[model samples]
Target: MTLRSTLTTLAAATLLALLPHTAQAAEPYPDPRPITGQEIIHDPTVSRLKSGGYVAYSTGGIIGARLSEDGRHWTDAGNAFAEPPAWWYEYNDKADPWAPDLSRRDGRYWLYYSVSSWGSNHSAIGVATSRTGLPGTWTDHGKVFTSETTDTWNAIDPAIIRADGKLWMSFGSYWTGIRMVELNPKTGKAIPGAQVHHLATRPDAPYAVEGPYILKHGRHYYLFASYDACCQGVNSTYKIKVGRSTSVTGPYIDSTGKPMLEGGGDLVLEGHGRYIGTGGESVFRDRGKDVLAYHYYDAEDSGTPKLGLNTLRWTKDGWPVVL
Candidate 1:
């Protein structure tokens, strides 16, 4: 090749390397790790039990539960609560709970869940505790945080993270996107007089973002959230996006350095192949590896929502990728 042509090619390659990762064509989403049996779930939050095996609680009849002895095969395990608490009726007539988050802390299991009617800002996030982290073992702890019709942010989709020796709970949907507030570790509820902090939101109307999960990896706090329309089955546009901040709160920036408060997030996972509308994600460390647990609509199965589990691998630059 001529010297001039070689120089031109080298310059083009250098420019491409300098561009943001998003500027390049994205790789296809990898399929979820295969599993069998009762796989239907939504907004799943999974955790390893103290005794053994794993348990998942999700949005559905009284916080539906599923259990897996080996993580690959699952079975329906009934609901966390045999019946909804009387207080839940204030948020919705059906007294149904949604998006239950399961975590283990201080020798106990904490379950945070949401209750609200469709298209209304009146919502509440409640907490429960279990000794074993198993189905039908939770003891109701009442509401942790809530929102009213007068509030600008809707309170739903609770995700908890412990950072810098402090407990924080992130929650929100539709009205104004994701939000967080400090929690009193002793009581496992929002601290009195604690200021609510804004995390992420889209610039456009209706916002269309929700389901926030924060994972602390290395020196940065990564925020993962679901973006776009969800619950439409085959027609759902839900996808998982992410941003990172050195601090647990505020000014999360994507690969392009755009703030998450202004519609900035790097695409992590999206619908591909038979897996349509992949979203409502949560991350858990299983046997030293990060595992992503979410629900996806199965195109081959009449758009039925099913459990999706994939290994979360990080790139050299520290961004997460599904493997």
Candidate 2:
């Protein structure tokens, strides 16, 4: 080769090395990985264990739970409660619980679960704590907050978050979207003087937003919620949506700059192919990345609800994407 050509090649290589390299963008909404062993769960929440295992709880009788030695393989850990709390029988006919939130704090596991009946606003959120977080060791703390028939919000799908030096819970369902309230850190119940704050809602009849799980990323508190009709098997139109705000109690807005109170949300995950009706999401940090966990109807498996997990990607503009 000519000396001039060799010099040109070296210069080009040096320039290429000096320029920053960027990885290829991940596929949007990449298919969730299959979870092995006893995987039926609705409105699931997962927490990483100190022993490097994972424990998950979901909506069911006595709050069904599963434990995983590795994040991939799971075994039935039984129910968080042996039987439903007696107070729950007043609201729900079957006395079954739904949408349990699991978290660990100060060397103990704190679980917040919702007890309510179908198509009714008479509901209550309850707390239970356990030293080991394993099945059956939890000591029930009874009802934390309850709603009467006159109330506009249904107190279900409890999620606890510690932000701004206080413990707060965000919960609600179809009646009036999602709501938040400050909680007594020591008792894990609502603070006496603090008032309930409204978050997101759809004004249309039979409002469809629910399952409020908040995750703080950088300067924003992102609210992840399920939208549309849930629980109809394959016919379910459920999907996941998100909004963010600088404050924990939000006037949460979407990427388009529309407030969530006006029915604005950025789509995170929805049905694709056999992964139908993807909703009931919770975000958990594993290793260094955020993992989005939920349940999807398996079109290939008789439309049964099963576990779904995916890595969450954030855009430079500060929005969450499932990848």
**Top candidate, metric lDDT:** 1
> How would you encode candidate 1's per-residue C-alpha lDDT over 1-323 as one tens digit per residue?
99999999999999865555565437567899989889999999998787989999999999999999999899999999998999999999999899989998998999999999999989999999988998888899899999998998998999999999999999989888999999999789999888999999999988998999999999999999999989999999999999999999877999889999999999988999999998999999899999999999999999999999999877658888788
Task: Please report how far candidate 1 places residue 9 from its true position, in Å.
Answer: 18
Cα lDDT of model 2 by residue, 1-323, tens digit: 99999999999887654432122222245789867898787888998887679999998768999999888988888898897778888878788899999998888899999888889889999999999888899999888898888988899999999998999999999888999999998999987777889999987978899999999999999999999989999999998888899999999998778888889887888888898999999999899999999999989999999899998877666777667
Q: What lDDT score is found at residue 204 in candidate 1? A: 95
* Distance from true location, Cα of 32 in model 2, Å: 0.4
Candidate 2: residue 215 lDDT (0-100): 90
In candidate 1, the residue pairs with backbone N, CA or C atoms under 3 Å apart (3 or more residues apart, or in different chains) clash, namely none
For model 1, state the Cα shift of residue 49 in Å: 1.4
Whole-structure CA lDDT of model 1:
0.92
How well does candidate 2 score on lDDT at residue 178?
Answer: 94
Q: Give the candidate number with the greatest TM-score.
A: 1
- List the candidate 1 regions with Cα displacement exceeding 4 Å: 1-25
| Residue 171 displacement in candidate 2 (angstroms) | 0.5
